[model samples]
Target: MTTYAVQRSLPGITMEQLAAAQAAAIEASKEASEQGSPVTYIRSNFYPADQRCTCLFEADSKESVEKVNRAASIPFDRVEEVLDIPPMQH
Candidate 1:
């Protein structure tokens, strides 16, 4: 599976909205996986000041990632494959 980053520009978004979006994404991913296009929702990072959010997912292709977002009714600007580097252990 390849990791992907879904970028969105959401102006005037609230915490409640963010939470709802995450929940929707999870549900949509699960549905997609059950339907055979396996996808996992990793996490999301929101920059309130910039009104931007990036969501991470592991899937077979960029189209899988985009399908999940579209199923969840989440609007995204771009979807790109990414390398996920873990933090260094002390």
Candidate 2:
């Protein structure tokens, strides 16, 4: 599986709405996996200042990630493959 980033511009979004969107994304990912597409929601970062949200997912292809977001009724600017580098362990 490859890591992908889903970029979204959510202007005027509230905390409650953000939580709901996250939940929807999770559920959508589970449903996709069950259907054999196999997408996993890793994490998300929300920037309140710019009203931007970037969500990370592990999936076979970018289409799989896009499908999940569409199924969840989430609007996104774009979906692209990304490199995920973790910090070195102490």
Candidate 3:
């Protein structure tokens, strides 16, 4: 499997909502890291209401990363899949 940076955009999402979602994400990351794979989920962007909320996650696949967003119940505009593969890996 390869590493992927999953970018999720949250639309019309407020700071409070983002805060709550972020709390849950932090907890989830702790749990998942303890369980397996040791993934990192990061929340970026200061103004979410005006701009889209961003999250960067390192996971093996898009499906797994999307599952994290869905499980967090965070309202998102879009989820971008960016695979991180190097020539050396091939």
- Indicate which candidate wins on lDDT: 2
Residue-wise lDDT of candidate 2 within 1-90, one digit each (tens)? 999999999999999999999999999999999999999999999999999999999999999999999999999999999999999999
- By lDDT, the better pick of 1 and 2 is 2
As a whole number from 0 to 100, the lDDT of residue 3 in candidate 3 is: 45
- Candidates in descending lDDT order: 2, 1, 3
Better of 1 and 3 by lDDT: 1
RMSD of 1: 1.0
lDDT of 1 by residue, 26-89 (tens): 9999999999999999999999889999999999999999999999999999999999999999
Clashes of each: 0, 0, 0
Per-model C-alpha lDDT, please? 0.97, 0.98, 0.62
In model 2, which runs have C-alpha deviations exceeding 4 angstroms?
none
- The TM-score measured for candidate 1 stands at 0.96
Taking the tens digit of each residue's C-alpha lDDT, what string does model 3 give over 70-89?
Answer: 66766555566655455785
lDDT of 1: 0.97
The superposed Cα distance between candidate 1 and the true structure at residue 2, in angstroms, equals 0.4
Model 1 stretches astray by more than 4 angstroms: 88-90
TM-score of each: 0.96, 0.97, 0.61
What clash pairs does model 1 have?
none
Residue-pair clash count for candidate 2:
0
